[model samples]
Each structure stands twice: as C-alpha cells, then as structure tokens.
Target: LFAIAFALLRKYPTNEEEDFDRLIDNWSRREQPLFIERALPAVTPNNDEPPPDYHSEENLLVFNQAIADYLVTSGYTVSCKEFCREANISINDSADKKDQLEKKWTSVIRLQKKVMDLELKLQEALQEATVGGPTREKRSPGEWIPRPPEKFELRGHRDTVTHVVFHPTFDVIASASEDATIKIWDYESGEHERTLKGHTAPVQDIAFDHTGKWLLSCSADMSIRLWDFQTYQCIKTMHGHDHNVSSVTFTPSGDHIISSSRDKTIKIWEVSTTFCIKTLTGHREWVRMVRVYQDGTLIASASVDHTIRIWSLPSGECKSELRGHENVVECIAWANDSAGPYISEPIANGGTEVCSFLVLQVVCW
Candidate 1:
C-alpha cells in the first residue's frame, strides 16, 4: 500500500522537471508542421556547371588576335582592358563583337538617311500638288496645255487695251478698254468669260487685288468702281478721284488703292469704304500713271513732265526720282525676285559693297 502511494505522487513531478517536459513538448509541436506529410527526398547538385555557351572558340580567338593586330596597325596603343571599356561590348578583347557593332551602327545610319530623303521627297511632292494645279484630276499633260503668250490681243476691246493682268489664283485674264468696258477671258481656253459694264466714260485702268476676289476699275467718268469677282455686283463706287481717274492699282495687301487723275492730284482710297485716305502733293503737272511697289514702301507716279516720282507709301513723302522718260510713262515693271537687287549700306570709307552683303538670311527664291 505504501509503495503504490509513493509511485502516484511521483507521477505529479517536481516543478523543474515539469518545466523541462513542457519545453520539449512545445518544440516537438512546432517541428511537426515543418515536415508536413514527410521530409523531402535529397538531390545531388549537377556535376560540371552547365555546358559552356561558347561557339567557335577558335574563330573567336583568331578574331581577337586580329583586332589586337589591327589596333596596333591603326596606332591605337590601348590595353585589352581599356579596349573592352571603350568598345562597350559584352566580351573583352572580342573583334567579332566590334565588327557586329560597326555593322549595326552603319545600318542605323543608312536607315536614318533614307528616312530623311523620303521626307524631303514628300515635301517636294506636296509643294508640287498645291502650286502645280488645283487637284490631281485637273492635271493636263504639258503636251495638251497651251503656253501663255507673252503678248496677246483682246479682240473684244474696240479701242486700245489700256490694261491687262492675270487673275490672282485662277486661270483667267482681265482687260480694260478705252471703249468703256472690262472683259474677263479664260486664260487656258482663249474664250471670253464675262464683260463688266457700268462706267459711261472710257475705262482707263483695271486692277485685281492680291486675292483675286475683287476687280477695281477707274474710269474717265471721275469714279472708281469695285466689282465682286464672284457676284459681279458693284460693291462700292468711289467718287473722290477728281476729274478723270487715269490709272489705278491695289496695294499688295489689298487694303487701300491708289489712283492718278488729270485733276493734278493722286488719291489713296480705302477699300470697303468710299473715303479717300491721302492726297499726294508734289507733281506740277497732270498725273498719268500710278503703280504700287511690291514692298509697299514706295508709290511711283508718272506725269506729262516725263518723270516718275517715288513717294513713301506710308507718309506720302517723295523718296526718289527716276527721270528719263521723254513721253508719258506708259508702263513699268520691277525686277523679278530672282533679279531683286539687294540695297547695300555704305561702307565706312565711302566705297560700295556687293549686293549679297546686305542680304537677309532667308533666301526668297
């Protein structure tokens, strides 16, 4: 009975012994999940590291040696390490890699040049499309189209064809006659398009502004008429040019007009309004012809005094004189853009410079 009691008491162990048993229980509980169902099977590592990635080691060696030899020939005294760094290739001292890079770079440059050339050709083609004709369908081969004559007669004009000019953006021509009528002709077909009639007196001059949307006529009836090219409506009749308005021209901007009269005064008239803006005063005789320069800086007028006077367009002040026409100056033309001479500034010592010296950076033609 005593032995049984002692054994039962021992089953309830000492504190130190109980603590060690609890620790062992906890450790085994944590390790149980690590094995899941069971521990994994062992595998040995691969024996010879992977097979080498080398291809043609002999050829590669030959190329590397050739590069070293060529570099020496080319006077490059670079070490192999330095060459590798400079070449930016993956392999050190590899001539094949260098050759590959050279070929790739050359291909890239060739492709870039081809792109640039194609872009230039595209721009030229677009330019030809706009300037050559209205539409692709309107293209008439050179053999079919008639060339414009340097001088052509307007048979419809009973008197002398006092003025003739092309339409600004179309295949049409306009002429003013001393017989008091203005006629429009098809420039390509050589056919009469329309006849504008309103002035009782002889039509002395005709002009089309930069847009070709309006036609302006000055007449011996002492009036200037503005005609819409589309509707042929008399948009406005200017009554300011004293006596007979002999000659007229639209400014390059189409904002204002200039007219010369036998009344001895030249008037600048504003478009869209019948008001006269300025009356140039200088001529001692009747003004015969007036022209507006392309630059819009000067107004040239001819008179019976047989001299052409150039006045500043903005202030109406006389700028220069071209004095040699013995008769009434009939006509004048500026040099083409190709022939436009540059006005050079005087040198420090009073010598003249070549026209190209004062040239603007951008070439117009």
Candidate 2:
C-alpha cells in the first residue's frame, strides 16, 4: 500500500486543466495495490477473515484516499472528500487511520526535500570546479627573463645606500647606508620598518646570517657589529681592521664571518668566540668587497688594485688572482653555486691567474 502511495505521489498529474477523471482512472489501473492482508500479515493482526481483493471498490477507495490526502497536503486545491466523490469512492476508513497515513506522508515529503537540497549543492560544486579550473603544483617554476621590470622602490635612506641583502626567510630587506645606519624595510610593500644606529661612521655593507637571526654590518669606523634581528640591538662588536671595514658576510654555516677592508686584508672571525681566526693578505690596494663561495670553501675579494683574488678558507692562503680589468675591481661574486670549475679553469693565454670569467647563471638580482 505504501509503494502504491509512493508511486501516486511521484507520478501525480500537475496540469489543473487536464481531465481529473482520466488521471484518476489511469492511476487506479496502473498503481493497484497487492493483497494487503496476505502480503502484510502484520497489518491485519486483529482480522480473522481474509480481506477483499485489492481491486475491489472498498480497497480501491483506501488507495485513492491516500493519494488525495498526500496531494492535498502537497498544495493541491481540491479537498480529500471532494476528490473521493469525483472518483466515485466511499470514505469508510476511520479518522485514526487517516492521521497515521498523514504522518507517514509527512515523513516522505521531508526526506524528499532533503534529497532535493543535496542535489542542488552537488550541481553548484560541479559548476564551480568547471569555472575555476585546475591549480598549479606548489613547486612549479615561474616565468624567467633577463632585465625584468622593477616592481617597486625602497626610498627611506638619507645617504647613499651601499649594500642590501634580503632576509633568508622573511619578507624584509636590510640595507646599509653612508648615513651611519642600517634600515630595514618590508620587501613586499616597500615600507620602512626600523633602523640600527650603533655604527659611528658610514655603513658600507650588511649581511644576514643563514638562519636570519643575526645581521652583520661593516663600517668606516673600522668596526664590524653584529645585531640581533629580533631585538634590533647590537650584541657584539669586533674592532681589528686598522682602516675602514669595507664589506662583511656570514659563511654558509653561520658559525664564522668573512670581512674585507681598506686595510687591504680579509679577516675571518669565529662567531661564537668573537675572535679573529685567520687573516688573508694579498691585495696591494683597498679591498672593495668580499663574497664567500656557496660551499664555504673559498672566498672572493675585489680590490682597488685592479685584481680579484680567490682565497682558501681556514688556511689563510690566497689561491689565485684574477686580473685583466684595467680599472679597480669594485665588486665580485660567484656566478653560481657550482662556479668552482670556472674559477679554477686555466686560461689559454699562458697566464697563471684566471683572466676570463664565464657566467654560469644568475641566481638573484
């Protein structure tokens, strides 16, 4: 009986202008219930006599009334008794049975409403995916081109900005200036953040350690000061250079520092002990800049003597001198992390020093 009622609910005609008598006759023939007492023995527990055939007028009225009750609850304009009269069926069932059927139909309608809501959500999800499309992997490479356009400028320094280095893991930049200060700025927004003011003279260079916990700066006052990145305080100061300290950088391991000066010497200092470990001397003029190889095995120094010298770490030995530039070599850097071969390659012009430098790659600006 419930299955026939469900079928009537699903296939009920919607057009009010259609023939109601024809719709009733079609549903009566197509959705006739089975033998209720025999098929559902539990429903007729009190009845000892067998019920009439499912097609009999009495049982048919029960089925028709169930349909009329469901349709009326679902917003049909006609009444249950009126629908029964139009279909020529008598309403002999008790009011209690009608209430029970009404409760069951209410539950079915609630479940049907929930099903419709879920289907609408599924369709919305599919449409969103189709419109947004797939996403790129996290490690995918971005666009690469030479001489890219500048995005923005950081313009807070009062004097000439000598050197700038990006924080290893933060969206900030540290810049040294001739105004005797090191300024920090938000790299993404180009906003001034803070300044370190311990240096007494012009600040020549600044570098952040590998962990970005400390900042090192060299000054014309012949001092190299280490500042805590978080507290912005000068934690340690080293004063061994006889002339102006020109450049400073931390080794890859962050345990030592390499600095060059107008004193024409490169000094390596132990970070923990605050002591000068080794000093490399070869340049006849002021050393302009110094950069350590990525592997921490070698150091490159540019000098006003028109030469670039490669020094071996820990041993304080000048390995080779690169020459041929007629003017002072103001700056020097390893072309790539694997630039050892290019620096060590013997020139074909019978010169002991590397005369020609080959650029393997450009890692950053």
Candidate 3:
C-alpha cells in the first residue's frame, strides 16, 4: 500500500494552481473581443440592425449554442439549477417535465429594456471617442458623484436579510438574516460560502471584530452569541437582556461589546469574561441600533422613539439626545473624520455653499 501510494503521488503531482492561472490568463485574453462579439452584437457594424424578435426561441437557440460552445472550450460545467440561479430565472418545480418549456417571453421584455439602456451608453461612448475629445465629465473641488453599476445579486436568504458587514481584511461579507442564520459569502463573486446557525430566533445584526478573528451577533432571542471566525463555531452565548436584542457592535479596541435591545436599554459586555458589566437605560422605546465612535469614547444609538442619543463610555451616562425625526431611526453611524469640520460649523452662505449644495444635490437626485 505504501509503495502504491508513493508511486501514484509521484505520477500525478498536482498542477492545479498553474492550471488555474493559465485558465484565467486565457479568459482575460479573450474577454474584450468576446464581449464585443456577444454583448454588443446589436451594435456591431456587420449587424447594424438586430432581429426584431431578438429574444425569440429561434434567436435563443443561437445564444444558448454560443454559451454552450464557450463553456466547452473553457473547460467549465454548470447544472441547470446553477445556470437558472445565475440568470435570475425562476423554475416551475411543480410543472410536468413534458409541459415545462424554456420561458422567455416575459424575461425578454425586461431584458430588452436593460439592453437598450446599455446600448445607448455604448453609442454615446463610441461617438465621444470618434470626436477625439474628453469622454469624462469635469467637477469642482471636493465634489464627488458616484453611480456604480450593479454587477451581480446575492440570493439565498429565505427571509429578510437584516444586515451585512464586510470582513475587516478578507474578501468576504457576513449577512444576518431573519431566517435565524448568519451567512458568509464571497464578496467578489457573490457566492454563498457557508451558513452559521445557533440562534433560535431571527438574527437582528452582526459585526466582526477588528482582527476578523471572531463575529458577534444579536438576535430576537434576547441573547448575544460569539463565534470563532476561523473555526466557524459558536464560542459563547451571552444572555442578559430581558427582551429582543436589536443590535450589537464591537468597541474600537475589540475588547468589549455594546448591545441595544427592545427592552429599552443598552448593555456593555466584557468580551474576555463574557459577562454584562453595565446596562444603560434611557430610550423611551426600543433601541434600533447602536454604534461605537472611532475613538471608542462615545456610543451612539438610535431608537423607535424617533430620537438619537449619545452616551459616555464606562460611566454609561447619556450625554445628549437629538430629536425631531418623524419616524423611527433604525440605524446610526458616527461620521468619518472628513465630515467633522462641516458638521461642527454653523450654517452660512458662501460662494460654493458646501452644505446647501449637498442638500440641493440630494434633493434633485
């Protein structure tokens, strides 16, 4: 047995990493031309006018054949369910096999609208390039306008996904769902990696510690659970709140946790001991979310009472309350350092009028 195993290992020395790199290099080399041929067929010079029924069954046959050929050439395989999932097409599970046919009539109408939008943008860019002038827009100093295109949608949660947090250092995201599970996903490819389950009730929020070594989640079960990120196992379940725990966050130092609950209170827990050290109560109604300041000196919380409160750490004393919101404030975050100067300044008129311009721009959009 030892001789046979050694012989096989020597004969089949793995080249998986080299093969994968070669495959990626080939894909990148073909990407531009292939995209032009398939994605922009309607605008190609040879095919100046696309078929009126571009998504008709006959046309779909051509598209499917092209995809199948590409898959074969690329050494890839996909099941029907996986293909349908990526295309966002629903499958009729109850339909008879003979009666079930590829449904494209409805999807065609929706896809045509999207294709038209892309075609317009492509035409504009093409014309701009021909003119030999700048194809980008100019903006004033400190002005930023971002309109990023959707790449892919992450699906699989059975219930509402309450919160999503990016891993501090990894290309992954943790999502808390009302399905009572925390799901880890590949942020780049939108792939569901694994599900972490322990909560008996819906999970309300999730956060990763600074080192990305652990994750903390609060749920409607009136408890908080800590999980080892590396092992994907629940390390400790901390229970203290009388009612549903709405939100949780790690202190800047990642040494402690702050949680807000429907019990109208916020509690600070010592992570090392997994014990509730202090519970601050002041919210007139259920607290929706709580966040720690960058310096870890202050904690900010929002509540169903339509007010925001700032609390001092260690002492657990409410320093100030901001009111005037007409509806529940479901989330809160401390502004980044760049916004400090503007937030602290009194409103005034100026040539640029940063504050008013921002307000008007938001309103117009």
Candidate 4:
C-alpha cells in the first residue's frame, strides 16, 4: 500500500488529500503482488540501495519527509494530514479542525496565484506606457494651455437663430431665425449683408446648394422656398406639407431638395420644376430634421418619435430605424470621414449630446 501510494503521489504530484484518497480507493481492490512489482522501482529511494519495506512506519516516515521537502522547495504548502495520507498512513485528529485548515491553506494558495497574475498584468501595462508609447497625454504640475479668443460674431437676427450654414464656395453665411427671415452675412467682415424675407412665419432652417448659387429655406408657414442667393430674390415656393416645414437640405447633386415637416413626412422635391417628387411617410411623430448622405444614395431623418430612419433616395423606402433616444431626436449628420456617421440630440431643457455609429449599421447609442 505504501509503495502504491508513493508511486501515485510521485506520478500526480498534487498537494490535495483528495488525490491520495482517490488513488487508494482505485488501487486497493487490485491484486497486491502485481501492484507491488509495478510500483517498487517508482517508489525506490535511491539507485544503489535495495528497495525498503515501505509498509514499515520508519520507511513510510522517510518517504513522506522526502515528498514534503520536495513540495516545500517547489513553493507548495501541504498540511500534516495530507502528507500522511500521500504515504497511506492514518492519523487521529478532529475532522472539523482538519477540514478548516485545509480550506484555509487552499484559499491562501488561490489568492497568491491571483496576486501573481495581477502583478504580471500590471508590469505589462507599465511596459506599454513607458518609452514614448501611444498613451494619453500627460500634463505636468502647474502647466496649463489657454483657449483662443473668439474672432467675430454675426448679430442681426431679432429672434433665436435655429440653423446656420457656411456657403459651399464663398465667404458667406446663411442663418435662419425665428424672426421670419434668412439672413446672409459676409463672414470675413462680420457684416450682415442682406436678409431674404418671404416666409410668413419663422424660418426654421436654411441650406446652401452645392454650388452656392441657391439657398433652400423651410419655415413654419408649411412652405419650402428656393432663393437666388446672389440676387437675394425668392426663386420659387414649393408647398405640400400640411404642417410646419422644420428643415431642408439639397441632395449631393443639387438636383433635388429634401425637407422634413411636423406633419410626420419627408418630401423630395425636383429643383428645376419646384415639384414634390416623392413623400416618405413612416415616422409616427413630427419629423424634426433631415439630411442627405454625401453620395445622394441615402437620406436620414430624425423625429419626435424618438427614432432615426434611413431611407433609400429614389425609391423612398424606409431602410432602417435606429432607436435609443429617450427624448426627441433633434438632428442628424454624416461625418464624411473614417470616424463614421453620427446624430445629435438636444436635451429638452438645453445641452447638446452626440451619438455615433457605423454607416448603415442601424445601432442604438
């Protein structure tokens, strides 16, 4: 039994008493002589000496001490009961106390292993952050950077300005205001150049065409008007929405204009004839804003319905709906870069928040 137990301990090399119990239970029912013959060489203490009678208490004590020494040198701690069990020796002790010590030592070994793993991970992180690695910028004590001063402000709008856009090819700015007008300004001189006045109600949005030749304006009067920006003359008026027209923008080619309305619809217009070519109708609440993708193949609209929907341009079919906003979705924009497309929502009371997603993926923020 001692020879078999020592052979099992040497083969498995574990500190747990369960391993010794399992091996004894498995081998004790087998033929004794054959087991002794197979286990004698494995449990032998030395090459030059004949095998000792391992069943003797003295021999068992010598073998157990050798195993205990090996375990200690290899950085393992085993209890007296476990060490004795590995040599098939019985011990008299309170079962509860033995179990408590075994559990405590097991927990200590587990915690030590966790600490070693954490130390290794911390060392790797420190190595990556040192020597000009791609880490966050570090600021020195008492050092600071100042913000640049504002250049100029264009101040002519009598009411809250809802939208402002820079001209595509000129040093001009177009701003729509609740004052029922779209104001043109010379940005370099910060001068209010002219105010285009035709809308009977507040002008909600204004967008310059791709060539900066025309400006599209939508208003609370339920109308979208195109203007010859250079002459400051109203070119044409397109009307189809039953409620306030909230926002408008020209498609990338400048051949069509897209407008969103409080009537929960998006209308596509032909720029040449001032005709409503198609109307998209999936939003359940007021459509707040609309924008065309750079390629003119897709259109995105946000609504008080708390969702943003992407629609195919010509077919006007709803492609995807993104939902997560707890309040109204106020605005949407394309980054036109590798960082991908994003939408912005204004909190009911004030601040602006932004959400980004991969183009056409339809994920919530």
Best by TM-score: 4
lDDT of 3 at 344: 18
* Model 1: per-residue Cα lDDT over 68-179, one tens digit each: 4333343444343344344343333444444442353356446556665886999978765555454435565552343344334547778878888889899999999888
- Model 4 misses residue 329 by how many Å? 1.0
For candidate 3, write residues 180-279 as lDDT tens digits: 9999999789899999999999999999999999899999999999999999999999999999999999998999999999999999999999999999
Scored by CA lDDT, what does every candidate get?
0.66, 0.74, 0.70, 0.74
RMSD of each: 30.1, 15.1, 22.9, 21.0
* Runs off by more than 4 Å, candidate 1: 1-154, 337-365
Q: What's the C-alpha lDDT at position 207 in model 4?
A: 88
Per-prediction tally of clashes? 0, 0, 0, 0
Candidate 4 global TM-score: 0.57
Order the candidates by lDDT, highest first: 4, 2, 3, 1
Best-to-worst order by TM-score is 4, 3, 2, 1
TM-score, one value per model: 0.51, 0.55, 0.55, 0.57
Worst 10 residues of 4 by lDDT: 92-101
C-alpha positional error of residue 43 in candidate 2 after TM-score superposition, expressed in Å: 56
Q: TM-score: which is higher, 1 or 4?
A: 4
- Per-residue CA lDDT of model 2 for 251-343, tens digit only, reads 999999999999999999999987998888899999988888888887888888877877778787877777676776767666556545344
